[model samples]
Target: MSQNVKVVQRASSSVRDKLYLPAIYDGMKITFKHFFKNLSDINAVDVLRYPEEQPQDITDRYRGLHRLTHRPDDSIACVACFMCATACPSNCMFIEAQEREDGHDEKMPKSFSIDTLECIFCGYCVEACPCDAIRMDTGIFSLTGNKREDFVLDKEQLLANKGAFGEVCSCARD
Candidate 1:
């Protein structure tokens, strides 16, 4: 098969265009227009005083921190299936499963930890979950720590995150 190549021609510039004076004036005009407009109505400009003043218009679909959902009986919804850990490309998710002593659930995570430093925030763990147990819709993206250990979120920490935002029922699907 033969492919045809299209020839392109450059647009010819006038003396004014070549001088670049009109472009500078146009840029200055836009700058001054914004300056005057902002001066007249301060609200027209978005000046977020973060940490002190939080944004009011965050959407529900915004992906933030990771959290594990709970069952109606207040127990963890996770079956310790290891699907999330298997799907994680970064290999940041760590989970150890154990038989439930209560005999209610088949299995429970003896230890579950996620190294935030290693995590790429790809949301694959959320997508790979089979029981609708995990979600990234907490909208709490300000994940910071002074020490490396603080970034390693354990099972308790992940569970605590679920309280901030309840179970995301509509997230994971086939």
Candidate 2:
């Protein structure tokens, strides 16, 4: 479509021949950089010997894993709102809401479980919870199980972090 005729250009074969060697040398250069850097640190500061010694303080907003709080009455703090399950991106949370007939103000979660396998560690559910019932602050970085059912976290495990981890739940049964 252009009025000017396009001049055809040919790539020099010498450029192609030199490309492979440069790439190989670049790869070797990276390897040598790491090797020498590690060696220098080991001799001077001894930084290479203690990679595991430095641990990280997780951010206050870090979403590590799911947790449910148990009130002082040994009852679930969740009000069967299903906000957490609904907010979860992976659809890992399963909840069965049940009403309490003992003059309770709201319905509570009778059976709440989270499939650890399906969770992608996103914190949407934690942020969405209005009651502050569900949290992902156990500092638990990894979760595993032998069977499929073993990965399903129950209410007891969720509340265990509250007592042991010092994250108190001020929710009272009013």
Candidate 3:
């Protein structure tokens, strides 16, 4: 059996294309055109004054800050499963588990903290949780802090955070 081999010819770059000056000039021309146009009509450019002007288009699907969900009894939903920490690519999650003091065999987190500075906001922790105990639906994209410790959210802070709809509990489970 004989196979036919085809050789494709590559296109050679012209002198102007090699220099790239023309392409650079064209890019600058477009940039300046938009700059001047926006300068003339400020309203043409959509600029949000941030902090004061919150974005109106934050959909339900938007992945923002992480929040720990609560059970119907107002207790934390997390059973100290360690699934979220294992699934975290950034290893920002830190959890300490302990046996529940109540007459239940289920374990609970003694301490659960997430270093927001180190977190990549990948939503893996939320997905890995079997109990739907964790979620990134707080709609708090603008994370700010003076010290690094401020960004590290503990169980209390995480539990305080409400969902995008301003609910403390996961609506899925509720």
Best by lDDT: 3
| Alpha-carbon TM-score of each model against the true structure | 0.65, 0.68, 0.77
Q: Where is the poorest 10-residue window by lDDT in model 1?
A: 165-174
Structural RMSD, model 1: 6.0
Better of 2 and 3 by TM-score: 3
What digit string (tens of lDDT, one per residue) describes model 3 on residues 52-85?
9999987778899899987777777888989999
Prediction-by-prediction clash tally: 0, 0, 0
- lDDT against the true structure, per candidate, is 0.83, 0.75, 0.87
lDDT of 2 by residue, 44-105 (tens): 64443334554365565566667887676766678888888888889999889888765544
Better of 1 and 2 by TM-score: 2
Model 2: residues with Cα > 4 Å off, grouped in runs: 1-19, 36-54, 144-151, 163-165, 170-173
Candidate 1 regions off by >4 Å? 1-47, 163-165, 168-174
Candidate 3 least-lDDT 10 residues: 165-174
Order the candidate numbers by lDDT, best to worst: 3, 1, 2
How far does residue 71 in candidate 3 sit from its true spot (Å)? 2.6
Alpha-carbon shift of residue 91 in model 1 (angstroms): 1.1
Candidate 2 structure lDDT: 0.75
Q: Write the per-residue lDDT of candidate 1 for residues 107-153, one digit (tens) a residue.
A: 88999999988988999998899887888877787788899999999
